[model samples]
Target: MTPTIPGFDYQRVQVAEGIALTTAVGGSGSPIVLLHGFPQTHLMWRDVATDLAADHTVICPDLRGYGASDKPADPDGTAYAKRTMAADIVTLARALGHERFALAGHDRGALVAFRAGLDHPTSISHLACLDVLPTLDMWQVMRGTNAAVGFHLYLMAQPSGLPEQMIAAAPDAFFGHFLDIWTHDPDAIPADIRAAYLDACRHAVPSIVADYRASARIDVDHDQADKDADNQLDMPVTVLQQDWGAALGFDARALWSAWAPKLAHTTVTCGHFMAEEAPAQITAELRKLVDR
Candidate 1:
């Protein structure tokens, strides 16, 4: 069982046909769905969710093929596409009695939130993406030295069996590498929580690889189509990133402005796990979205 966030009730909600989401829900006010990132579960939102629960109903879910959620065998990348993942979240909130809600995501989840804002504009009232760029822009921005930071993206983007096979051999090290490298503080994640993450990854090799693979293939196709159509998110959007653009030689805000017209962009000093590294600040930012 996933460790329960304080004052939250856990549920395996059937959000679609044969798709059930492991969700953690708490508080009572306007709804806001929090999405977790790669190499972690909804538990990543514990501090932020509990803090926001004072005024907002926070819903955190393990995205499809992640954590304790239903992991369908989707080697083709179609099922793991952000389009499908975003639909899963939209369906989840509806099941929870929310027709429209605020949305925030970190890492992989942020990608899903990006899709949610584009595909289901009326469903999402406010959207926040932490520590990521859009899928197409992600590939465009990372080059040469900057690409080194995204080595896992290239590794996991490989053919179906290969990535999963290599990951299966040493799942702990493969996942824990990010756990160790992506954070500003080693002590930010509790030892017990780290162990849980490692243990989960050990058993989730294929599904997790499939999720990453989709990002490289089908997810990129979806994003490219959106770009070709000149599509943009028609919602109040907030972006908090670590300013990879500074080191990467690109204008992050310029890229994001193309997607989010009403954008509130800030460069956070924290690492990839900003929600954990700066929960108070993240919570305060989300509260601003709430007030807006």
Candidate 2:
């Protein structure tokens, strides 16, 4: 059986024409949506969502191409772009009766949340992004030997057939590599949850690759257009990230500040999967962000 957040109710909510997201919702007061990262599902937000659900409505959803969500084919390449996925999120929240709410995301989800804040500024009251730079800054900073850390990004960024075939040939190994190396605490993922993640990725190789591919192309163009227009996030924002700057030789805070004027940047000591490895810390930071 698939594991789910203990008290959360799961449902299918149509966020766009012919696309409905598998969402898990709990609690009651203010609404906040949590988007999970790559190679994982809404399950990644289990602990944090449960805790936050105490006073706030916590909505966690499998992104369009991940977990149990609908994975529409990307015939035109725009289907999986962050701009498109971000719109899905905005619609999801409105369909649930929230015109504005706090938004937070990790990894790929962070990219979506970043775009949402830019494209739907009034709809996101507050924003928090975990462990990822904006798509444009991400490409700008990754260089030389340090760029090797993002090999999967380059591999998936390739045109259609090759990346999909390469990843589909060995889905578990391809998806499992990030889960294995990026976590500081093995117990955080456990065996069952890890198996579930692997199974999800094993079944969604093509759409997942399309998501990353969009990042390399159209997503970058959108971010660049926003940058050229001097458009920035108009809401208060909180960023939590591992110290990639010291390792990659770029100031992570500076990169983030260029887009988010009202920003609080923190260098986390936990691994990249900070939400799972350090739920208490992640919860506290998110609570503070929501209050801001």
Candidate 3:
């Protein structure tokens, strides 16, 4: 059976000059665009999107490089930057007839959602970020041994060739490693969906690496510029994470406060894949953001 978001109609829509995103659209009401994280696609939002679909138009997209979307090879890595990915979401929402929408993202998606909120404040009514810090904060906080926790980030950030070559040799293992280790519940993502995630990541090795590379390179430049400019998220912003700040001995809320002046930050014990491990809680927080 094809692994897909049940009841959601899938479409590939052009979001930029050379970029088109594969999106799953369903339900109807206040629009909410859900962005999936690394090595995963919109499938990450299966539970949360379906539940939220009852009341809102939930649009889930496989960010440009991660799924059945355009993966333009960018030597400078700007093509896969969160700035570019965020623009894809803005164009997608407008194309779907939503001039403005509520936005939520998990992991890498949260990164894009972060950029979207920063870059397209007028287009996002409320923003919810799951299991991630702003790019600038993410790089700042990971120090010494703590940085070891994100070995993949450093690995993929290397200039071309190596990461792609090594990961491509064992794509399933690379992608499946996160899908397995990042969650409190291994079965939270069932077999078929897991297979789909693995397959997608396996086939899109270079593009996925490019996406990560940009985070360490161009994405940071954009984020640092935003910071220097003192740009804050203009809308209500809610951040949900596994309390990495507490574990890593940093003030997570205090850090988020700098980016989101109006912020509601929550720490969950649901592990890294919070949307899947604790969908009800994730959905509730998202609903609250939209209502707020």
Candidate 4:
């Protein structure tokens, strides 16, 4: 079944060589690129995109290894780095004729958005991150039994074949585990959306793992470089996260303030899948961010 989001026109473009990006472009005015997270495709933003597209041109793309985007083999971790992935968005935006645009990402996409804001500050007009902390803060906050909540981070962060093979053999279980556990309301995701994620992950296992592995090593250096440059998103930033990090020993808002000069940071009761679990609230928060 081809799932549809009302009011948005779906289009596929070859945004990168040997890799075509499946994007949904709709509405008018300034552009807002929406990036979806791990275990999901651009479809995760269906409802949110509709809301935003009424007045703003919303561009939602399946990040390189997810959704309908090309899952071309990137064996060396060269392209899957969020930095490179972030650049892809910039290229896609330029192709769409926007010199600068607002960006919002969820989960893995949040990390990518962070990279885009820091690395190409001039290209991203506004930044919004959903349901994730900065990578370094996430590393520091996980310790003891509290770390169990994010065991996949460590598992996927491990070196080489182990994590990849383990997940490949049981991709369904691996991806479904998150869908079942991460949501406070599983029904909020609906069956087709959940299946779409599992299907994408199963097919794009290597690329997905590469995305995580890059975070473990190269992404750290990327983040460190931004910190060293004292480069921050000059535009307004809105960070929405769950309160879980607090229980696990992290001040979510305070940490974000270090990277964003103008920030509206808050924690909600929603679980990891905030976009799906709390659509109304998430959409409202995004409206506030875009309007700001």
Candidate 5:
């Protein structure tokens, strides 16, 4: 059986034509939607969601193409664009009876949440992004040898066939690499949960690549346009990130501040998978963000 967040009700909700997101919802009060990152699912938010469920209605959803969510083919390359994914989130929240709600996302999900805040300013009451830079800043900072750390990003950003085939050929090794290296605490992701994430990635290789590919191309264009237009996240924003900037030779907080004027940026000691590696810390930050 698949591992799941205890007490959370799982269901499929249509957010777009012919596309339904597999969502896990629990608790009851104000709503907050959590989006999972790459090579994982809504299950990544299991602990944090449960904790927040004590007071807030926590909605966790596998982003389109990642988990059991509908993975429509990207014939035009826009299918997995963050703008498109962000719209799906807006529609998903409205479908679940929330015209507006607090939003938080980690890693790839953070990219989506960032786009959502820019595109649907009024729909997101509070915004929190965990462990990711905006797409444009991300590309800008990753230079020369430092870019080697994100080799997977370049690989997936390649045109169509090659990246998909390469990843699909050995999905376990491809997905497992991140799972192994990105966590600070091994016990944070027990064997069962890791297996669940691997299994989900194994089945969704093409869609996952498409998502990364969009980031390299169309997503950058979208972010650039917003930057050019002086558009900013007009909401209370909290950012939790590892001190990647120091290692990568860029200021993470300063880069984030360029977009989020009302921003609270913190350098976390945990690894990239801070949600799992530091759930208590993640939960506390999220609660503070909502209150902000």
Candidate 6:
């Protein structure tokens, strides 16, 4: 049976130039877009989106180069940069007649939400990020022995061709490894969903590798440039992350507060895949963020 998030309707919309996002729409009232992280899809929010759709209009999209979205060739890292990916969401939302809406993202999607809030300050009403820190802070603290926690970052940060080639050689195993390792609750994601994720990653290895490679270099530069310009997110911001940075000798909340003045930061006892592992808790947190 084709998996479906209850109360949600899925569709593919042409959101930008050569970019048509696979989006799931449901509910009524104010619109909210939920972006999923790496090695996952809109499927990550299967439970949470259905619940949110009971009240607000919940829109979940597989970000460009992931899932059912368009996978155009990016000549340089700029194309996969968070700023570019965020713009794609902005375009998609506006095209759907939502001039202003709350935005929430988990993992990689959260990075894009951060960029969207900064780049399009007037467009985003509320912003929520799950299980991530600002790109600049993340890079600054990842060094020496502490880097082992994120060894995949180093691998994905390499030349795009190599990681893409290597991952493609065993796409199912390569992507499935992260899926299995990142979640605190293994049963949260069903086998079919897991297979779907692996299929998507396998098919889009080049773009996926480019997305991470950009994060290592160009993405950091983009984050720093925003900081230097004092272009902070102007809306209410909520950041929910695992205390990995704190364990690694960095104050995660303190750093987040610096970038988002009207911010509520909390550390949750969950693995990197917070959405999948703790859907109810993540959903409750999101409601608070949206209600705030």
Worst lDDT run of 10 residues, candidate 2, spans 243-252
Record all residue pairs in model 4 with backbone atoms less than 3 Å apart, i.e. clashing: none
**lDDT, candidate 4, 1-292, per-residue tens:** 8576677787777767887788888889889999998778888888888888878999998899887888777667677888889888988888888999999999999999999998788999889999888887677778999998888888988877899899999999999998888889878888888888898888988889889888888888878888888877788999998887668787888889998989998787877888777778888888888788
Candidate 1 C-alpha lDDT tens digits along 94-206: 99999999999999999999999999999999999998999999898888876988898999998877888888998888899999988888888988788878877787788
Winner of 1 and 6 under TM-score:
1
lDDT rank order: 2, 5, 1, 3, 6, 4
Question: Model 1, poorest ten-residue lDDT window?
Answer: 71-80
lDDT, model 4: 0.85
Compared with the true structure, model 3 gives a TM-score of 0.98
How many clashes (backbone N, Cα, C below 3 Å) per candidate?
0, 0, 0, 0, 0, 0
Which regions in candidate 1 have their CA more than 4 angstroms from the true location? none
lDDT of 2: 0.95
* Total backbone clashes of candidate 4, pairs 3 or more residues apart or in separate chains: 0
Q: Pick the candidate with the highest lDDT.
A: 2
Model 3, residue 256: displacement in angstroms?
0.3
Ten contiguous residues with the weakest lDDT in model 6: 1-10
TM-score of each: 0.98, 0.99, 0.98, 0.96, 0.99, 0.96
lDDT of each: 0.90, 0.95, 0.89, 0.85, 0.94, 0.87
Which stretches of candidate 5 lie above 4 Å from their native place?
none
lDDT of 2 by residue, 111-212 (tens): 999999999999999999999999999999999989999999999999899999999998999889999899999899988899999999998999999999
In model 3, pairs of residues that clash are: none
lDDT of 6 by residue, 1-292 (tens): 5466777788888977777998889999889999999888898898888888888999998999898899878786687899899999999899888999999998899999999999898889999998888889888888889889788788999975787778889988888888878778888888888888887888888888878888898889988898898878879998998878767898888888889999998778878888778878888988888888
